[model samples]
Target: MAWDLSVDLIKATVQLEQPVGDGSRTVGTGFLISDPTPGGKPRTILVTAAHVFEKMPAMSAKIGYRVQGKDGVWRFDPTTLKIRDGDHPLWVKHPTRDVAAMEVEAPPEFVKAAIPINYLAQDDTFNRYNLGPGDEMMALGFPRGLSANPAGFPILRAGRVASYPLAPATSFPTFLMDFSVFPGNSGGPVFMAEGARRRPGSNQTQEVQFVAGLLTQQVELSGERLEIGIVTHAKFIRETLALLDKLPGATVTQAKAGKTVKGDPPMPPATPAVAISATAMAASR
Candidate 1:
């Protein structure tokens, strides 16, 4: 069951690529987020790395986004969606957070496969799992543009949690793990075990289920052969969801948001866009 859940989560995330200077390309990852747009929904929002979208020229030929399918397979196409707050690049710099988000026209082949993220609810359960040193985590992504390699599916890599949390570097609670992340894995998911918490009266805490963090950073030691990967706390997931709600005409609302069913809601869809943070600034040398 745990294995299945991990696969399901990967099926929902995507790798984004855009043309950069001199015909080179920048790559990152993002996962699908639920939008409440009405029928003929233009695009789905994908959260990923900020740097991936930054190096693009305004009139680039085309953008590319890739995601896993329901069958645990990789699928991709040229993206027609545009970066939301692309004009405000400084607000979404990599050193401070390293996260970026954009919307894509839902492709006909991918409509039923994507899963909308419940960032708020996931954030509420962050503490349900006591992640700490020595824990093992599974980080899955399409590294080195390997989505179509080997088996044409997302790659899964396992690693151990690092010596300490990464909050100091990212300004948020983060996990340092020993996963090998390549270019295409920048915005993938990093899931860790959240064992059942034991209460004072109870013998042990019951097991709670869900994803733990969004893979964000990695550190390469000069002499060491292996690298350490970092993941941002789940709270930022909630923040991204909130910002999505503030978009001009989004229609998605959570079950607790005065809505019960998981069906689509009425929405006046607008062009897909990436949202930029207001207080965030660019990293200095």
Candidate 2:
């Protein structure tokens, strides 16, 4: 069967939010990936921008999981996910990038909805697919904490590759996308859904669909929004997932005082509302 990234990935994407003491909630996006363990045990991994989880000071956040009833109606059913044990985070973060990953126990339907691990783009994916500036790509997220509908689905948006030199992922860890990015859009999947594209240096066309990266920040110059998003390469996501195994075990516990412990400092305060270059702002209500 032909793969449909829009539908396939939308099912895997979910909204993450937690209420700050001020009545407003900090919000972000996340998606599920089917990454089985080395022992071949089925596992689901939640992938998102590290700042998304970092900005949520509370130990638990709600994951918007929708349920479909027998009548074919989908209902929003959010569940609490433990993200911290007192002050320490439970998710693994990339050493330098904004990507983060953590193991999650999702409902059976969601497990099936998780995108395959192989769907993440590798270094060769861009060159092989002739992806470059001007190529169109799609992103899924809830901008400004707004969902697509009452069922709590993410909003899909499209944009073009705005920058050049998309390769290696060593020096250029991020690429630019010509899109209007807003808070709550961070951590969403940025992907290519081109059905068929001619391979580089060849007349043959191949169906190219893969996750390119995660939306990390929005670029701004002086105090104006540039409508351009910065996407961290998926390579860092893979690296962060690998770190999950090396790090000491951590678990989520019930919420306590809702105050952060002393030892673990909160993530640096978010960039100013207006940024000089870029703003790493996760959406807040």
Candidate 3:
């Protein structure tokens, strides 16, 4: 498989964590996406699920980043990406959606590492793909906060679109991916990358890729869990960004570094979502 999709996915995704009452922490995932319509300040927002942050007990959480050392080595650096200090929510949730975004200043190199807004599939663009049930898709995330290597890179998982009429996803705020999601996979990029495909009448194949959407939940029956992942359509993400555009700074209240925070409802999951917060689950374990 080509590495472009995996590369971009891992480069942009990070782990979000905060301490718990027992001196431990819960873990979730988040990724970097540029505001689709930037007006003045070239905004870069951290994208994740509202439920992920809502389960937190502290206003502030640390984001995990991989920084390259002068020795040409990558190191896992836990950076303090503050949200709110007290009762204020650090992220702006979509009015009726499970998604949320927040503005923040990150390392210049990291900002540059963000996935471009255009990478997301749009109305006409998504229509072109002609996706349906069983088409292959992939996601980059940390399952149970575990990465492939020591540098803290995300793990790549592949699945198919389990929802029909995959196009015009706006009508359907969410879709489904046929992948088993773990506790820490929420807020990760659920996308299809550009790749080669056979043309109908020709011996030649064409390359294509798309940011299908963001993974939100995993599908599970009350008694038996299925390996299905629910993904929020990227359209709502665009809508949320547009909503933020209306705000002066497109920001939620700044989460103070020292303040302790305490923090959902699930998306009426057609498919299951990865809702087990590492912190929340770990405490119970």
Output the worst ten-in-a-row residue range by lDDT, candidate 3: 264-273
Summarize candidate 2's per-residue lDDT along 1-285 as a digit string, tens digits. 287988999999998776665445677899999987776877788999998888887887877788898999987777768898789788988988888898887878888999998999888878777779999999998777778887788899999999888997887789999999988888999998877788778888878889999999988677677899999998888888778667555332332222333443222122112211112843210
The true-versus-predicted C-alpha distance at residue 88 of model 1, in Å, is 6.5
Candidate 3 segments exceeding 4 Å error = 1-3, 199-204, 251-285
Residues 140-259, candidate 1, lDDT per residue (tens digit)?
665654553432345678888775543333344666676665555676767643354464466766554455666665554553424666676655654554465455664321111122
Model 2 pairs whose backbones collide: 184-283
Q: Taking the tens digit of each residue's C-alpha lDDT, what string does model 3 give over 85-175?
A: 5787767889987788887666776678888888877876555655678888899777766776767777889998887766676577777
RMSD of each: 10.4, 6.7, 6.9
Instruction: Give each model a TM-score.
Output: 0.64, 0.88, 0.83
Q: Which scores higher on lDDT, 1 or 3?
A: 3
239: Cα error in model 3, Å: 1.0
How does each model score on lDDT? 0.49, 0.79, 0.70
Candidate 2 residue 115 Cα shift, in angstroms, is 0.9
Between prediction 2 and prediction 3, the one with superior lDDT is 2
Q: Pick the candidate with the highest TM-score.
A: 2
